[model samples]
Target: MKSISFPFLYLCTLTAASSVASGNHGLYDVRPFTISLSDGVPRMLERIRDTELPDAISQYPGNEAGISLETLKAFRNQWLVDFDWFKEEESLNRYHHFTAKIENLDVHFIHEKSNEPDAIPLILYHGWPGSFLEFIPLIKKLTQKAKTSTGKHVSFDVIVPSLPGFAFSSAPGANWTVDDSARVFNTLMTKVLGYKAYAVHGTDWGTGVAWGQFDGFNTSARAAHFAMLPFLPLTPEQLEAQNITLNAPLEQFEEQRYVDWSATGSGYFIEEGSKPNDIGLVLYDNPMGQLVWIGEKYIEWSDPKAGTSPSVLTHNEILRIISLYYLTKSILTSGYIYFQNPLGQTGFRYNYTRARTDAPMLFSAFKYNVHYWPRALAETVGNLVLYRNHDFGGHFPGLDNPPALIEDIREIGSYWE
Candidate 1:
């Protein structure tokens, strides 16, 4: 009986060891596989044509107004038919794009090589509501300027990849967060592209990934640049002590707008992070729902002048982002990322003003969004090399106001030398 008992225990222990080993061994090279996107489109379109999102109300005084009839009209006329995917596709493909396998997912990215040899390589990361298209205009001018006398692109060789579940990149597995996303991007940069050291730039959620990369990637990502800095953990007392006034206006007009954004604009964030799948299902089922969700951001966040802001999305930009998702069918996976790193949502909740990046961070703060002014906030992040209060450009500056956006990239891009 004692001999039989000992054998049974030994077998149990062996089984446990085998299971742990199987799960833990993915640290080796992560080669991704390509998944095509033909079947998913019809399924998504059928839902769009047939479905109607329940008219949900905002949690405020003008609740009914926020869910306005005009918003619906914009969705029908602009997003449904006017937006042309082929136009944006042709434009986006003009840049040098390449795809590679990273951590069990096929990753698609735009790699714009600079004409200059000493060009400092840069990687751009965009948050939700935008894709690699976010960085297109800036990249074009950087490569075009022939900036240096030697035509040596000085500071960066730009590499912009779609976040997992965002575009061509694979969606998150059961366990992927800002940390995982950062690590994969770093891998894309250092392991696959072979850059020993490089600078990273990002906006919105991408900012968090960029910061995480600074800590995770051993070889590169030592330098990080992000626009929306997280200062969540800090208390009100600490903020005042640091001379950071949350409600004070930097401009003389004196009305604080960020507080308004926190009250209203941040609802999507809570929805996505708290109930990602619910909203994702809506986005997945109704193409109109996806447009309402994403299209509004482009309208509210982009520059109003070109009359091209999300307020009135042209058929071009809106379809491009939606097509990327539809062609990929990554909606649920994209939303699931919220839960994977709940901490990532609070990433800006900390009190630290700046994490101190290694490279020169160009912060072209949007003129309208008062969340954080470019000049004051730059001190909290990196080597505040260039601070431009963009007269034009809202959230999607590169796309909203391309020519001005291009000029800024050309001017500061030469600094890599």
Candidate 2:
């Protein structure tokens, strides 16, 4: 793979109160950055256009077997002809993009402050096969004042940070864990950005970071919300021992879905956790390979009804995310999180006592999520003030169903104070 570098110039200055001088251990000056990929876009496009694809094999219709050959061909055609990276770049630059040195890493984030008087600070964390790009649409909505369930108007000073080693954020060392990420982010909010208290929302691996914040910085992380939880839930026998009645039908459905996913859809998990370097090196220079590696999850793990009716997770949306991963060349480091904390192995262990947090928590469970636990089981994990279930969304709720996610976040905000 050819070497790629981002030609970014610090364009704007921030208040002294919000940043420290350069060379300090704390947040070095928060400087605005622009995304530039001109150096490698031509080669990336050529690769996409010239790539060879095998004949379409249809043992079963649609994506039942895997990401269909038809899907790959369509995406390739769109990338070569219709997709415009510059236009996407312009759209992203509409918001404020900045990076501050935290823990010796250039932590990239989109920090949009609300003008509303009652606006609160909120930090969003994105997980693997995802980046800060996932929350672009949601960030705009969140920064605007909206009425909550209690009729109180609220807006947010939204902070969307690229997880270390995921987009613009500097990659961490081999031993770094989500707990380390939680500490740095907590410092980003409290020390660098100067927020006395803040709220948090997370999805995928971000869920683990949020859990760490909830467990460690309960005071400053005043309120918490999650679209996904990382801990394995208690077994049926364990729940029965606690006198918690299972919603039998729903449990049966979720169990079957889990079984099917474990059987077929979790190969990426195992590979990423066990041998990230192998797959990362293969996909690093291969744009189509990266597309298949990440795009397949966006298709299979999202609402099946997406791209119909309301039209979410469109071709452009998926392509933009893939492009970010390719252009940034962070695909290899992004998978390192899996190697550091392999779920269902040495990752987070479920302990009701340890999981409990004083901060109020809200959970929004989208039915199409790849993994699930009943509301009864989720409640025991934290101070779960609200657990809302949705029939129409998936792992990527921000794109699959923005309105529902927006509503849930606002509802959780009402519980913040």
- In candidate 2, residue 232 scores what lDDT? 62
Model 2: residues >4 Å from true position, as ranges? 1-27, 58-62, 233-252, 309-311, 344-356
lDDT per residue as tens, model 1, 134-155? 7865775565434543364444
Candidate 1 error regions (>4 Å):
1-47, 51-64, 78-81, 86-91, 146-156, 215-219, 222-225, 232-241, 244-255, 306-315, 343-346, 353-358, 410-417
Q: Which of the numbered candidates is closest to the native, going by highest TM-score?
A: 2
Q: Residue 214 lDDT in model 1?
A: 58
Residue pairs clashing, model 2: none
Against the true structure, candidate 2 reaches a TM-score of 0.90
lDDT of 2 at 102: 80
Residue 369 miss distance in model 2 (angstroms): 0.5
Across 210-306, the per-residue lDDT of candidate 2 in tens digits comes to 8788778988898888997768655556667888775666555555555668779989888988899999999998999999999999988888888
lDDT leader:
2
Query: TM-score per candidate, in order?
Result: 0.76, 0.90
